[model samples]
Structures are given as C-alpha cells and as structure tokens.
Target: MSSMTAPHPIDDQWDRFRSTLADASQLLLCLDFDGTLAPIVEEPDEASPTPENEAALASLVSASAVSTAIVSGRALADVRDRIDGPKTYAGNHGLELSRHGLVAVHPVARKRTSRLEAVCTALETVLEPVPNCRIENKRLTGTVHVRSVPRRLRPVVRRHTHAVVDRFGNDALEVSTGKRIFEIGPSIPWGKGNAVALIAADLPSETVPIYIGDDVTDESAFRIVEPDGIGIRVGGDEPSAASCRVESPTEVATVLDWLGSVGVDLLESDTSELSSVDTSSFE
Candidate 1:
C-alpha cells in the first residue's frame, strides 16, 4: 500500500475491514511505511518499523495462507533497509517490484534513469541559491530534501522543483508532498494499487487483499481493489476511498492482530460447526 492526501481515523475501524478477510482462501497483507508502520521522521533513512510492528507482521506472514508485502514510494533498497528485506517489495510507485525469489523491473525505468539524472542536475542548479536545502536522487525519484531547512523556505523549495521539472517533457515525472518532504519522480502511471492488484492475482489462490498505508502516495491502493478486497487508510478523522481508517501505525498493528484473531475465530467456528454436523449420513 502507498499513501493519501488527507487524514482519517485509522483506529476503531478493524471490524469494518474483517469481512474482507473472513473466510478468505488466502490473505495478502500489503502495507506502507511512514505513518503506517513507522512514524514519519526527519530523516527518511532513520525511519524504522517498530519492533512490535515488525514482529506482528512477521508472525502474520508465517501464519498459513498469508503473504506479505511492504510497498513504498521510497526506493527499493531503502524500503528494504527499513523493513530489513521483507518479501514482495514495490518501490517508487510500481517502478520496481521484487519478491525474495522473483523480481520484475519496469521497462520504463531502463529508459528513464537519465530523466531522473536530468532532474537531479536541474535540482542542483535550481536549489543552489537555497541554503539548508538538499537534492536527492533515489535513482527512480528526486527529492528536494528540506527536512533540515527552516519551515519558511518550503515555498521556495516547492517553486524551484516545479520550475525545474517544467523545463522539459510532460507529466512524466511527479512531485509528491509528504510531511515536510517533497519529491519528484519520473511521471509514470504505476503505484501501490497497481502493485497490489498484480500481486493479488499471482498468489496461489484467489485471496483477500488488505492494504494499509498513510500518505497521498497510498491513495493508489485505496482506489484499486475488488469487491472483497479492502483498503485500510492510516491517518486522520475524515473519509476517503479506503473502506475504513485507523488512527496510527500502532493501530494498524492492532488491526492486523485483530485480523489474525478473526482468522482464528473463523477456523474455530468452522471446526465447531463441523463437529455438530453428523458425518455418517453423508458417508
């Protein structure tokens, strides 16, 4: 899962999402970082999933009929570093897709590295006058890192990013805004939703997809899903495309625990129902 623009209640919404997973033949747990699992940080590199969240997700993945993915707009390696190499990582929207044993590289990325390089070049030139600002190349994206910059300079930074990218091409590159972080990337039509949809069909069975995320980038996941699939937005007290919302990353973990519980409940209930049924009649 990716992120969204607005905020919504991510807590107290677990039951709303349980039907999507109850009795599901398979469950795909798709998640986002930065406000979803890990709280946003001044330094992107410093953002790490809390040990509890990691352990919970690890446990869920180990459970039968479940798979996991950490999808983020952050570069693949960077996300890998944070989650420490979880299976099924999709980085830079859907530009890079990888699982432990399989990998899919977007063809556009091969032709588009230079475009990112060009954006970096332009960023270096445009941001030269702005002190306390840094331009970063994530290979697939360019971030005008202003985390260290004073709040007053944000407008100046945003203006410079728009001006530089406008110099050439169409909307082939994107500028995404996050908590004090603004990024530009190749204008490609891929994102978390696309990743989730692709991964969903490839699972061994037709599974329920539950996406968890916080950020505008995550809206991609919020938009794509079948009738049985669910998008769990992690943020504010407002409404969104996501069927339900939770308040924080901790709540996300809580909801996941709830999902595990639901699966257990379903298994137990099925067992009890079967026990009550007389099998000799059919035999």
Candidate 2:
C-alpha cells in the first residue's frame, strides 16, 4: 500500500521566499479576512484578529514598499471595520472594491440587489423554525449561515436554501458554499480572481502578489497568483491550487511576522538584487 505525505508548511520555503520579496519593486499582500486573519467563530460578528497579527499587519501596511489588501466575503465596510490597516479592500467576493479614496461596485451585481434582498427575506421566513439558521444580508451578497444548526437539520437547511435560490432563478443569482454557510450573489463573471487581477493592474510591473486565504472560494485567487506570486492556503488537508499551505490561523500569524520582518529588512537595506523567481512549476 502507498500513502501520501502531508503538504509541507509554507514556513519551510522561507529560504526560497525572502528573495522574492526583497527584489520586488512593490509587494501586494492580499489576505482573506475571516479564516486567514482571524479565527473562524460561530458568530460572524465575533471574529477579530489577535493583537500580534494586528500589529504585524499594521507594520506591513506602514511599510513603503508593500501594499496590503484584504479580500473577503464580508461587505467592504464590514471588512474595513474589522482590519485596521490595508491599502485596498475587495469584498463581497469582489462584487465591491474600495482603494485609496475610490470605491466601485460591479454594475451587474448592483442590478441583482433587489433579488438578493428578496432571497434573504424568503430564507429568513423559511429558516425561522430551523434553530441556529441565520441570514446575513450583505449589500452585494447574502449568506445563510448554518454553523450553529444541529447536524440533523443541516440537510433541511440546505433544502430550504436551494429552494430559495431556485425561486430567485439561477440566472439572476447563484449559490456558493463556504464553511457552514451558503452565499447567494449575482451570477456574474466576477470573483476573487478578477478582483486580484484588477488590483494587480494598478501595481508596479515587478510587484510580487502574495495571497493568503482559507476557503473554497479562495481557490480562484490561488490560480491568479500562481504565475508570478505566492498563493498560500490555510487549514485544509484537501488538494488545492495554492502552492503552499499553513496549518491554521496561528501559523498564518507566523507568516505575517515573517513578512513584516522581510518588509523591514528590505526597507533598511534598499540594495538587494532584483531577481525573479521561477514560476513555471506554479503554472
């Protein structure tokens, strides 16, 4: 019998990684809010990053050579309120973005706002009797959270969620699953990948994009960063498009610390060779 070994931790690759950051003209550090920065909590409102991670992020944000961004399923305002310092934010799975002083919402996503609201209302009515089922109405997207629902009633929750999605018409809205949640957003071509690409367009030519996320939805971003950047997945045993994996939010903090150190070193030295990493294997 043959067995597969566990994926190597992202920290193990530091020797091969620091040079990429040191050499880049700019560094775009994109992160997912909930699982990647803060520990996943049963109540969404309770999620917050640890003090150490918060300080690390603040340091990175303050660094002149690095630009920090948060890409999340939460609303743009919500994520902005959660994370103290990031140069840019992409929220509602990239349906909305806010950077510098400009904010943009997808025209197509805006068109489905009424539809999303109606679905949330319908889901609220249908899931009322099902204990622990909560409906969150984000402006660009809505999510039905079943994390606290009894396991036996999970199937019922899924059934009702599907019925609501069907009632709204799949062409107008689509359903996507996340950890213990079902998200309903406009069925458009936009996603995290498109958001990252858009953000990258404004960056310098040699900007190294580093994306860290922990969800099925994050796979799109992983693909985007594979070509010339680093894609890190947090807390999963399954095969993912991400080139590296960190075990949990604690490990994610460690990575953030490493990045903070790299940023500080690069700023202090300001004379490292501008070398590029071979990204062919990631492709």
lDDT of 1 by residue, 191-278 (tens): 7788887877666444667788877777777777534677777777454567667777877778777766665354223222323445
Candidate 2 lDDT tens digits, 1-283: 1122333578677865777766766788899988889999999999998777788889889877777889999999998899888868999999898875789999989988988898999998999999988999996899999999999998899988888889874579888888899988888878997898888877657788888999978888888987478888898667777778898888888888888876457533542433343434322
- The residue-level lDDT of candidate 1 at 127 comes to 84
How far residue 33's Cα lies from its native spot in candidate 2, in Å, is: 0.6
RMSD of 1: 7.0
TM-score of 1: 0.83
TM-score of each: 0.83, 0.90
lDDT of each: 0.72, 0.83
Residue 229 of model 1, lDDT score: 72
